[model samples]
Target: MFAIAAPSASAATACAKTTDPATPAAPSPGKPCWVDITPYPFGTDGLPVDTSSLGCPAVNAEKDRGYQSQCYLRVTSMAFRAWNRGLAATTRFQINPSPPPTPFGVWLFNGTRWYPDPTFPGASTCYGDTVVWAGKLDYWLIGGSLTGSGVPTVCRYDGSSFAWQPLEIPAETRVKVLSPEIASVRAGACYAWDDCWFFGPEGVRLHWDGTKLNDDTPDISSPSLRGRFGSAAARVDADGHRIGVAVRWTSHSSQDGVKPEDQVRPDPGESAPAQLLRSDGGAFAPFPFTPPTVPGPDDPWRTNLVAVDLDPSGRGWVAGNTVGAGNLQITGRILPGRQAAPVVPFALSGRAACTPSATAFTYAPTSSGLPDGQSSYIWNSLSVFPDSGDALAGGTERPAVGGTSRNDNGYAEPVLTRVGCAGAVTETRFREPDPTTNDAAVAPANYRGSLDAVAANAANDAWAATSSGSAIGGGIPTGVDQRFYQRPHLYRLTDTAKPAATAGDDVEDRPFEVVADPPIFVEDAPPPEPPPAPDEPPVITTVPTKPKRVKQKPSIYSPKVSKPRRIKGNRYVMVVTFRVRRPVTVGVQALRKNKVVSRSGLKRFKGKRGTLKLEITRKHWPTRVRFYTRSGSTR
Candidate 1:
């Protein structure tokens, strides 16, 4: 295992690149040009930032608007970390749930001082995204908390102090809302949507007033409907109107690896009862989905969406995670009228998947292995920041932005890259020497699936949250062995009046570390219990257990309506690796006007090669399907 060193005065301290990458010109890996994340030695070789008598950091800005600038990061000593077991306790990579929640804040860098955002809401708020309204630049947001755990509140960052201002939605309006993926325009108020989260069987959307943000079911082409949503990305569009979107991954029966904890209600349609819904502003008509483009069978799962900025002019872009099945294709809808989707061409191979919901368990690939020790907890939320465009003649276009790449160390940190400007999703490894990793862990050095949420601000900065530590000593991720501390890591990358740093210089800068409040102790507790085996029947046997066999009849492919299974949105997967010899193939389908519109598909091959394309597939979402050859079924 090679290690990344801190930037030093001695001889440039050079080392080997983690993965092989092409030029940045490539759109999808298939494209001729693509670029990998260039590394620099700015980190402290995993050392804590020296706060000392130096007190808090002073506010700083980049030198010129075009030359190289740096944010050499610094982690606050008060910061907590939860690594190893805490992350894997759940089957998927998500935030670790604490019996008692902790509230904390991290002061961020805006050139100079580390600004602060107070504690995370109640217990349920861990996994989700954040949104910053750049139009209101002096302030930013740190929202996307969970329901019951907390209402989605926006925090204000005024250089020094941080405070929480709740999003105001009219009470009594029962719209189940999740973390909102938002986008702000240099003009108009910001707009956001809840791609996932639901109320009484449906998901909802909201609006953010500078003071308090809340739910505002924007009327759409189709009636605002509901579905299962997961990861989503956003950007401003060509119109300058803040046209953002949220995505939910849902299916008829099976979805993701587990059965839907609950079912979707009020099918998008009613008379005959439509299944999906879309919104325009006044009413939510039936949202007509076209079999939108998706990365192939091997890519990570993501839905395509676009947003437009609004004001004296207009500008913005679209965002979608490109790594599908194996295609790694993401696109942008910058041009108005009829614009084609841009396919990202950088293919990162090692990422593999397909964990099916109970409905499609039989179809998952047989031998695919998961990133070691990784488990996705909750689909925390998505936050879109207001786009602050620079002045230009002949109407300048809105800058496009998207997802963060994981450093080799395994923790999925973020990066500020060009979604359409440069091409392909920017990436690195979740490896050691990461200036990040301020929490404890479940297993030693295992930081993959812990984060439950992700958020982004106008200046191209983003934040991802997860629970890393707990109450006692030697728990999942206790002591100095911390990693994700069940806290939010506020990471920001800005395009200032400074020149961009070379790949070398970029890696050497220090990341500003924000310390947060201690975990909050949750009230109203419930009794803890045991779970069941994945494929086996319950061992419960008593009276009715009197082995009674009825004459079972089988004919037409009558769907086998089995009893529902129990899952805590609580448990985590054990740290384990199941590998596949090759890549698995996947198929895709789109829905619109309450009917299936288009269908496309791609393939993802497997590999350990230093450099490879990692495309997330449609099969990985809602129905996170994973194929297992030995079981002769998917799970």
Candidate 2:
């Protein structure tokens, strides 16, 4: 669990004050800033866990415009690594007596502040869960129980509150599977909230249609297929259809060793014949496309599909690593209608130069032992913007040096590849400022980890989640406990390409900090109005005769309510009408014995303010109807 302290208003005011107060400051429009808001000491309770998923709403969308620059990071596990050697007596580990019952945590940012979700419903006590943005103020949580011995729990947020959805898992498979491991969750392309899909290992697929869950598992008769990973873009086509893609493969690891508690990673022995499944608003089926092949020998098991994403135009992007001959990073696009494009090899040129050091390890030539530079560039996560076909691939890049052995040292840095719509690729490698230096422009320190997850909004702004720790083979110094060296980190890349705001610019060169203190721009005051001229006798003119004043009635009128119409089990819809002269918020309440019991929540009505009709849905029938507005009420 993590706790976030709200940034104080005083601190914001102090940062907004200009250093040179005599001169007005010019706005630095489209200036990019990287804010490092990593929680100190890792998890508040125990060791920090890797972020499992990242999601964000389209910042440019009309509905999400108010939630400027937002992203959600979900962490659902604990880190436990066994070091081979003992540490010095001075180094001690903070060990928890037991893991928390509900270890799932969701963190969010709202342009100004980053904080954890206080009202997350974690009744399942499950170790595996994911949160995905459905729509405005709506998100879906899907995963299995903590012990992986029961049916998965599905919860949803309905704008105002959270509730457990009545997801009906298949009765036959529920007992046999024990716990289902959900690998990916996506909001339905056509209906974000009303329709959603959950995918898991072995081709398990479940669909929720706003009411009950339906088993949409595709017919995968092959026993060799062990895992199925898939992703869908949130864009709907002209025909109101959403497209998605999935990869089914067999892992080299034994079934008994594959535990639900373990984080999802590409197994060394994993092999796929490049088989892909496509979803077109229905159950997934085999597609006629061939993924990028490994260059070495013609071995089916040599290539592994690590991540897949579909853009709004139904273009599919796949990222994976090939192990044969020499390790190679591969990425390519699948055009609409199952058309496979040329494989785009990840370019190592034009990347930030890596720092050479004694502790640096060379990129390994094979995946047999530890992952070295050879596999460093393989993307672990992929995110494609729905509005723009632009995509981002998160992985590690060892630009420090190229060698055959782990002893050949070079620092590894987290890398992000931006794949443009026109097939152009740009790479950004992150390096943190040296902590010992007061000047940020000095030599930087190596960021020794991979970006495990990444998300992008429609504005092209992106966020990446990684951890700060010693990389394997980046030899840890004596007396330093490896367990205490790692901490979860988050980085935000603001898109300065959007139109400049009318307000004052962001805090000048605000440096990244451990705390979540967002730059608060100062709003420029309106120019003073000029004084009326007094030199010309005030321009005296005859005034027209005034009409008599007429008193008007109140703008809000009483509501006309209709009887509740039962639609389904315990659900009913009631219609209410309100007459008003101006726009106002309307609310409905269910009452018993003159006491309010249930509320429909206030909904704003702004348009031609006459008679406004509203449909309120409730679970139970009310004895009396109470309709009210901000100004008036009617029972």
Candidate 3:
């Protein structure tokens, strides 16, 4: 969108002969015109300069307005350089003559403008920290070591500003030189910043209760048992009480002689099965089920748990990559009760065509418009919507068809996998616009980069951030300059509205249906038409006989229900297991207090047997289930 106008003598000269009614009268020749820039230039200050004509709309003219104007300008390289150079010669515009280098810290958006962490004295020290956890009411806890002293520190944000929270490190951990840097945090619903837990290297655990940090490391039976905690997620109730907490714990050893920075990498032969610690507003303990295995024997370098998240209903999800196999997988389970299901493969689609070779992963369009190769994903973040149990995993994907090379030689596009509450998986890939086009407007798309993080709120509004460059193990295209993609980008997704019914349209809103095979019959002859006419039998030469029919047995049988488990406040989850001789439509409803409060609308099952989970929110727990099949219903 770089359409620069010819340089004019003044603003008045640029707008002198506009025919459009919206155009305002030209301003005085010496006056500066207000300009609103897009694709925000983070390192530069916004200032109007005497330069090229933008042919801006007259609606932006402030003839009668006091200050703010509607003049808009898309930021281009030329315009940015001009604005920066003008800052040095002018005194009226108070802006930095030279912007500082990009800081190694997170960026904050205040709806209108972006502020780097360096702008805040309390937050600047925590720059380059890897762990950031969001809390209620826009509160955030950023964990890192003090800038110079290396003392572990955590800065708390109270919506507007940040203040460092005091810490009380345990003597044993300090003496061991365990580092104890905060690596994960889970904020529970409590007064102010109270009732939150901080986890870090060497199993360091601290609880903040608004006043002080308490060393609250859980005690395991085995003295030598230690692990590096990576991610911690929690679900809270309407009353601000913690319902459950799930943390990712990877096996580690202090005696391994690994440096603090390298502690996350397990020693040779030290990788263990994926472990998850759970808490019920109390001390953390091992979850009952085994989490999906992330590291294989051949590729032990894979992180144990890349990301973990909990839905509002307390269901937990774990996701990570399998480097050896070049696959990304995710698993979910109802917390503290159900068994962790096997890693479910993403139902991938919308893949771009690419050709796989030893040195290159190149897109090769097919005549039929079909993709040419398989795609592989590398997950970076996972988030579950608090209101809906839907989850989204964000990362980059590249073609992985038949290449033997481990290096990412192909162009990678941001990809997202969404898991719905109804147990459906969908994958989406966002490819930047083609840069070969001659249009200048399409040129900016070349700088768009890899998606790194994603988050969704209770409103189901989602936002994702992209880093400016290729991901780890990823590479830039052969002919592109790296500097052009230095700035990161953010994107937001709004939910789509459902289509309304049209007038006079008789659309049937029917649920899933299963039709059983027609029944077989064994016919029986009528007894000689009865004494039909016993009196008239002598006169009747012949009599016709009708047949009786009998119905055959059904193919579906043997249904079982599990005990109802309470999730939170009157909400319970119950599972039903059944076996069918053939595929059928299955539905379930919970009977609570002689009332059917919830139902799992009919769903088609292709397998001969499976389990259906039903959730109900009522005062009384369900005692039994009413299972439905196409053939009939069962208790």
Candidate 4:
């Protein structure tokens, strides 16, 4: 039977890189992450040096909207040192070096050709923690000087060119939960599900700042106000002592953000929904009137958060993709715990109207002849087998700038024998390589770059980076547009025959293969899903069987308006004339000293066309006529 486990994609990597799932095995000792996955960088200066020896792009792809662009950058270290001499290739346009001199550049790996990331080379990207930034910290660093402040964007990696591309999605766009980072010294973490994060009437733009979240991006309308924001964060600790912090923005906040259950209305037999319940670290009785709003209703702001402590008691932080009952959500560990009972505090919903309508995926790397089982740099979580599958996972240190291949046509797999998670290093891979397709939007090959991703397990390692190469090996979807399709794929480091399991670790030239579960885990009780977005309101296709009100319009002239409208007319009778439409509002005033001379008996009118005969006009005539509307406009 073709078995599909009902587990998070992370949980499926148990037997990753192994042909047989029935038995537990171990992969050969692997090297550091940098050695397993290959990447290249293009700087603002030019091409970088190449030490990986994985030949550079054979040809440079074109630059266009439909086609990819081209550019170059200098190569830096992948846990070691940077190199020189490489190529920039892609179909996105121009592979310009990102401002502030990013060591990591993006590449598109086409089968026979290589395409540099022609678009914004490094200004701003969704790729999270994996990539190295100036701070040496692992959070998703975003500092491309295109502030739109009418001034040149400022950044540290300035090689002259400092232009930021316009934002594709407009502001006021709600960001649900952006799971962008969790950086440590050892393994890194990040993930993006536009389906999960893109949300709300106002799109979100929350980001993490290593320790706390800095959600308050200047509002376009306000510019200085730091509003409620969404982001990701994590802190590292070993044996109880704090090491570092990891934080990220999953997707801003949920599109249809969190709301109190409509105040509950006391549920008749139930206690007052507002009645607070109490606990020590939890809620207090009657849930103090901590009104979600501050000061007043017009306050217009509130902030929500999701954070992590990498050093859990047993279970590590839990992060992954989850869906069921038409509701989808992205969950992250809030409290630091262990692999068994890690904190699963917060979750983002997928019911947003901004669900991912299209998707693109890469090859479903099959372990086949590779090692049986092993944890990867990305999957070294505490879970024995996060996933119930046979596979290994990994990410590359360099940007993907060559051809794509699933087979192992190389030298030695990584050689780091000490297989374990670290304080500074926390390992993690992507949700899935399943192609999420969209035609107009060239299917993105998510080798989201090392900053964004790259993990390696003993059995197999996987990396997602910009590629201009055609997919290799197997598992690509049928009838895909290979001509311009530089696809994404997972690669398992093939294993060498082991001698025995007597060694302390599965690595160190061992005999019996060491098998571990997949890299991800989710709670048994499903997480909460956000409400549907407001954009795509429910569609009512069918016509109503019963008749309904159709059209109605008000007349222009009225009996009272025939003559010059008088302000003070018949006392008890409003002699002014106006027509009545569906339902409208209008304000009339006797202008005096540039102010409306409203009297105690100012009469309120109901229709658009009315004969206003006031009883007390204070012996004055009306000055001006004005129209108002309840529907957000002036008539």
Per-model clash counts, in order, read: 231, 5, 2, 175
Candidate 1, 326-358: lDDT as tens digits: 111112211112122221111111212111112
Pick the winner on lDDT between candidates 1 and 3: 3
lDDT of each model, Cα atoms only? 0.25, 0.43, 0.41, 0.25
- lDDT tens readout by residue for model 2, 1-635: 55543422112211111112331122222543344443321233322222332332333332212111222222321110001100000011112254344322544444444444555544344223445555334455554343354444555555322333434456543433323443223222223555666666555666766556676664444433344443433445566666656654333221212233321232344443334566666665655445454222222343345566654456655565433111222222211111111123221112221121122111233223233433345455676654555667776665534333322233455566777655666666544333322353311122455666776544424556663433222213343322222344555454334312212211122111122236679899999999987775656688889999999765567657765544344445555666776676777777766766666656666654433222334533357767776775654
| TM-score, structure 1 vs. true | 0.35
Cα-based lDDT at residue 219, candidate 1: 28
Ranking by TM-score: 2, 3, 1, 4
Against the true structure, candidate 4 has what lDDT? 0.25
After TM-score superposition, the amount by which residue 29's alpha carbon in candidate 4 deviates from its true location, in angstroms, is: 10
Instruction: For model 3, name the residue pairs that clash.
Output: 1-441, 24-58
RMSD of each: 29.4, 22.6, 28.9, 29.0
TM-score comparison, 1 vs 4, better candidate: 1
lDDT of 3 by residue, 1-635 (tens): 11222212221222221112443343332331112122322322222221233532322222221111122111110000111011000001111253232232333433233333333343334332333333332233333434455555555543312233434355444444344443333222222334566666556666666556667664433322345665666666556656444444344431222333433333244344324566667666655334343333332333345466665346555554332212222222111211112222211012221111121111222233222364545565677665555666776555443222221233454556666655566555433322333232121221223455666553323455554432221214444332222233344343221111111211212122234456679899777555434343346556777778887555456878776555455556666777877677778877766677777767777777766777766565666678766675655
Return the top candidate by TM-score. Answer: 2
- lDDT, residue 134, model 3: 33
Cα error of candidate 1 at position 429, Å: 3.0
